[model samples]
Target: MPEENYDFMMPNVNFFGPGVVKKVGERAKMLNMKKVLIVTDTFLRDLDNGPVKQAESSLLKADIAYVIFSGVEPNPKIRNVKEGKKAYIDNHCDSIITIGGGSAHDCGKGIGIVLSNGDDLPALAGIETLENPLPPLMAINTTAGTASEITRHTVITNEKTHLKFVVVSWRNVPLVSFNDPLLMLDIPTALTAATGMDALTHCVESYVSVNRNPITDAQAIQGIKLISKYLRRAVANGHDVEARTNMAYASILAGMAFNNADLGYVHAMAHQLGGQYDAPHGVCCAVLMPTVEKWNIISNPERFSDIAELLGENIAGLSVMEAADKSVEAMIRISEDVGIPTNIKSLGALPEDFDKMAENALKDGNAFSNPRIGNKEDIINLYQQAYKA
Candidate 1:
């Protein structure tokens, strides 16, 4: 291989496996995380023996005092970030611990970034706009995940403007992140399916992205293989520790890939759906993955063919274009079998809104890394295709 150069990013430390939730407190204490603000959604905080309790118990054991801020919402809103920041200040917290899935992590990042940088999310909406570093954060992820646990970017929706913003900066990346399969053992099948597909999207999108390098490609390919082999098992039986563990590994790898290479049109489009409809982020990605990838296949047919093999296709003597088609078919089949809706129309979205969303999607940071750049009209057409699927 020739020498290839690209930036690689990761959390300071990652703890993986069963019972590692306890490490949150241990690591927090080691980092001198006193009076931590635990950011999460109400549902996870109320769930019995869920991620919140697991995190709380660890903090208690480590004698780390904490305050709970359970106001984060699905497709997390701008107000969620503002309220979370207020909670952090009012409680006089020194660090942050976010539990649950991507929403929780993103909310925490937004809060921490604003607390140190400024109150305006729109100001810091682009890459590396934050002036100050965030308070130390430790993310204890629950779902198979959107990979927010490790990524440096935060997605926050400005409810007033109906715009979703991605805040990308190293300042807000979790100082530490880890995945404990035990935390996911009780996850509902639908959530497991959605999050699993979310991870798969990350791998495939990054693998074919313009910013991708040899390093990210290796991680993306491994992530794709793991998701293909384990997502169904994890969705079928959350109690199956092996399946959960492998999917967790896949999430970790996917996070690393997209964190560096970044995402493509799938995330760009999904963010629009999430901001506009408050749809489940992973489900939005799941429903759009096949449609977007099919449209993008021409940009890198060889890579799509490779994704087909990772998705369990027997591509033995198939041409590149044939294998690429097989890959899109595999994505559609997996998404359908996992119970994700086949079309965006089913999400109660309006075609009338597509024009505005397409404009925003074109400006999304993820769209910049897509192999084939799309215009507002192209994005609108893509939405029409997804809606008609």
Candidate 2:
């Protein structure tokens, strides 16, 4: 067996808890940043009821100059990054602050990478392709999912090919992350459930990924437990601060796990679904996760057994394989309880596109880290199961 090297990387600074948004100005000042590009989405910029304004108020109160670029969309595309780059340069922004979910943070990272390296967007597609350091980035997470704030990976879609590319590097990890549960209090139940399940997928896939290590396993297992225990409470009542806080912690732990251990076929496949169908990334993962795990259990039943236990299933009397099967069942029950539809069809995915999505997923960076090596046939089967669900 090749000895595993356990090297874990996390953001240097994390300010978590309620009202952490107020600290952004002080933190930016400490970084010596005079002007910041506040990267967000249109929903957040509406300012009628958004976290961006709260962040903006903090910056303004501190006498910091900033520009708001709120054009990012779900499943952020290369175009979003390009436009954000233009905004950054035009505003002469010295730093980047992302206030939203994964899309906004990813757009910020993309802009920072392009700004620092002067590399054409297409050139920086693969893992570790970035050669230069990116500008300092502060990510203020409004959602309890995606955890893009602390991750070194960014997913950006190519509009022409409809392919989602993953970029990984230590340089891409945000300099600081502010995770305030207060920002998530008003999120609708459906969005809450979808994003919470996304966090669960991260923990499950990272725990069983081929790249798993001791550190990641520990974090992933703990994250899974937290999500299982609290996801429903948060989904049932979005105003439950304790549930929200637990979900927030789970998001960070899951991010820490997957950030280093990497993800599996669920993410690899869902990226394609998101890019091609313009679907919610979390919904795609929620729909595909069970099918992919069922296929993966054959490769490592013991790991799945661990997942079962983490999900609060009684597996003591069962064999590892049976316990692993129980884990899949538990995932299905939780997903359904949270109102996630059982299949890709529920999300309007066409069956005819399965072949193309499978092919793209096979070529995804996350596919390389799955516990089981799947061919196109296996991928198709997983898609079919998800489609039929």
Per-candidate Cα lDDT values, in order, are 0.90, 0.90
Instruction: Provide TM-scores for the models.
Output: 0.97, 0.97
Error of 2 at 210 (Å): 1.4
Q: Where does candidate 1 stray beyond 4 Å?
A: 1-3
lDDT of 1 by residue, 82-182 (tens): 88988998988999999989999999998888888888788888887888889999899998868898998899998988788899987777889979988
In candidate 1, residue 384 scores what lDDT? Answer: 94
TM-score of 2: 0.97
Instruction: Give the CA lDDT, 0 to 100, for residue 174 in model 1.
Output: 88
Model 2 error, position 72 (Å): 1.2
Please write out the lDDT profile of model 2 over residues 192-245, one tens digit for every residue: 998999999999999998888888888998899899999999999999999999
Instruction: Kindly give the stretch of ten consecutive residues in candidate 2 with the minimal lDDT sum.
Output: 1-10
